[model samples]
Target chain A: MHALATLIALSLASPAAPLDWHPDLSSAEAAAEESGRAMLIVFR
Target chain B: MVRPTTLLSLVASRFECVRVTDMAGVDLDRHRFDFDLTSCILLQRADGHRYHTFGGRTWEGAESHLSVPALVRVLVRTLEEHEKAELPPRGRSGPGRTVEALPPLARRIEAGRRPACIHCHSVHDWQVEAAKEAKRWRPQDGWVFPDPREFGFSVDPIEQERVVSVEARVEGLQVGDRILAIEGTPVLTFGDIVLALDRSGDGPSVRMRLLPVSGGPSASPVERVVSTSRGWREPDPLLYSWRAMKWNLDPSPGFGGPQLTARELGGLGLAPGTFAFRVQYLVDGGARAETGRSAARAGLRVGDVVLSLDGRSDFRSVDHVHAWFRLTRRAGETVILEVLREGERRRIDLPVVGLGR
Candidate 1:
């Protein structure tokens, strides 16, 4: 019983999946120019 | 029987300094204490002393009805009287002969720890999850985290891609550039581009299959090879030691000074409503290396008041100076410097250094 409870707790503690962005170059370029600062587009 | 009366009398005497008024329409007769947004008063007796509570959900003390100043005065007086009563006569010989003292107990017992910024202040039981989420949302707030791209190259849908082809349009590509293949393998989404780039063997050039930005059969399927520069691998906006790039212009005479004093680098003394001096970093150096030592060697010393740079009258923050330097000056070039140091006025000539990454 303790093991089962511990397993449930561990499952709850797990982090959510990372957020993803849809690739769109035009929008990306527009955002970079709008900010008037350098933009970094990172892919995981 | 008399002890309760004496304690009540003593507490009432302490509260004499504060203005007290009876609160009507409150169940003071039943619960002996009633509190509202503005004030609270206790009429009940516990252990012979009437307890008065106040200040929102967190009652400061049983005697919370008293104002802060009144409470402090009463506490100090009580401590002083207690000490006097406990002390022995001057001739007495023992620990009590000198003076009786209260052990070190906090006069104000905070109910809970205070909140503090992780970057600037220390706090207890800081919420790791909340802090981490905040940092992830605004990673720039953290000193250790580097910005995503050094050259400010951020992409929409920020993901890696294998270039199917490289083409430069005079007007620039207007979207619809697709990857046909990576190293001759069929490519699909942007994810394939990153995977292919990773798997591509160590080489100076990578060959990629390209599709035309315009949706039509290419006159001919093109295989494009792009060359990567070794120097390009070096981080742009190079990091320089902050101690090497200090310059100041004095605004005392308000920009039209015939002479400027040059003093040793003194601490930044900013006053309210005063114009600020600019601290420029060497374009080659990153923000961290942009401090006094790098400044001193770069012809800037303590106590040099900045007046103007690059036709800008306001050079207040370190960032302002850095932006001006990058936009106006080039490496190995001399820039005009008007500074006030050591009570003497002089115009010193200084050379610009390349930024380090």
Candidate 2:
């Protein structure tokens, strides 16, 4: 129970990982293709 | 960066995020969006086949249609759609064309005025320049990324896909309708609707599939159509005048000023809604000086009160007059300007000349 509590506490205390933002389309497309993930390209 | 950590993390885990700030060397053929948008989000496959898009702004403001909740909803919905869909080919099937590949923009770059970072709107400006140079630009070409409001409906900003209201002119669509598809193209976000409408061409009407919100979760989607005799995609001059691409359009009327006050209109014997504006300043110098010079040569002097252009006096403002001229008239045309000069009515012929850059 104590170990479970510690894991729960750690999960709650941990901040969400920030998005791994690729700087350009080519690199992002490559990463996406390799990972079998769709791309979210934000043009700002 | 988007936040509320948990939601953003969900997005981060499921999608490859890319933040692009410059248009230099970006593929134009693969990525299509409204060049006027300051910030636009495109969702696509690894090989650049578009799945959905999520960004738009209005003259009311850029953030009016955007919110964290709406974006999260779009991301989640896109993921759901992706899972159940047949995926396209994993790689680009055809060659790519970059923004620099545009012939007119290439010439400008060759001239050494290449910007360190080309803005999204600059691509549109270059296209307009190219079209004008080629004598292929139509007045309707200025109308782009047609707003849903132009068609008499507005969606819930938070839900993004749920209809919140419909203008009385729009028949068969209710206030609480949830859009399923536009002309058989499934739409999960406002950007999808926009792209669908843009691809709908200059058709007089559009068909939509809507799931009525009032019908509950078990309700089946129904087909509805909205149409207009006046081009539904045509933009209001007041709204369209602010677009940066207008600078590349022709017939830049030289002079502009505040609309004539009611008292001034009364004194001039003009009706309240007449296009009466005093010439405050004329474009006399710089790259656009020829426009002002053209007006001056035609006897349009500073302080002259412009009453009408080509017998039309229903302009909402001086900006409207200029927008109307640019979108409706072309170079090699002559505009008859009726001005109240020194309390006397005089007509002058102003030649609409191209401001070739």
Which candidate number would show the highest DockQ if scored against the true structure?
A: 2
**Which segments of candidate 1 are over 4 A away from where they belong?**
A1-44, B1-155, B158-174, B180-206, B216-222, B225-299, B303-333, B338-347, B351-357
Candidate 1 lDDT over B111-150, as tens digits, reads 3332221110111012222344344322111111111122
Residues A4-40, candidate 2: write the lDDT tens digits. 2223222222367556778788888888877778888
- What CAPRI grade goes to candidate 2? acceptable
* lDDT, model 1, position B184: 65
lDDT of 2 at B228: 53
Per-residue lDDT value at B77 in model 1: 38
For candidate 2, write residues B1-357 as lDDT tens digits: 534446645664578887777898788768888888777788888777787777776656566676666776777877887777666566654447767877887887899977798898888987776777788887678788777877778888877778887887777678888888888767777877777777777776789888987789888988888675456767776566656666666668877888889998898887776668899988989767898998899898999998889999877666678777877777889999888987799999998877653
Q: What is the Cα-based lDDT of residue B290 in candidate 1?
A: 34
Query: Residue B157 deviation, candidate 1, in Å?
Result: 2.5
**What lDDT score goes with residue B117 in model 2?**
88
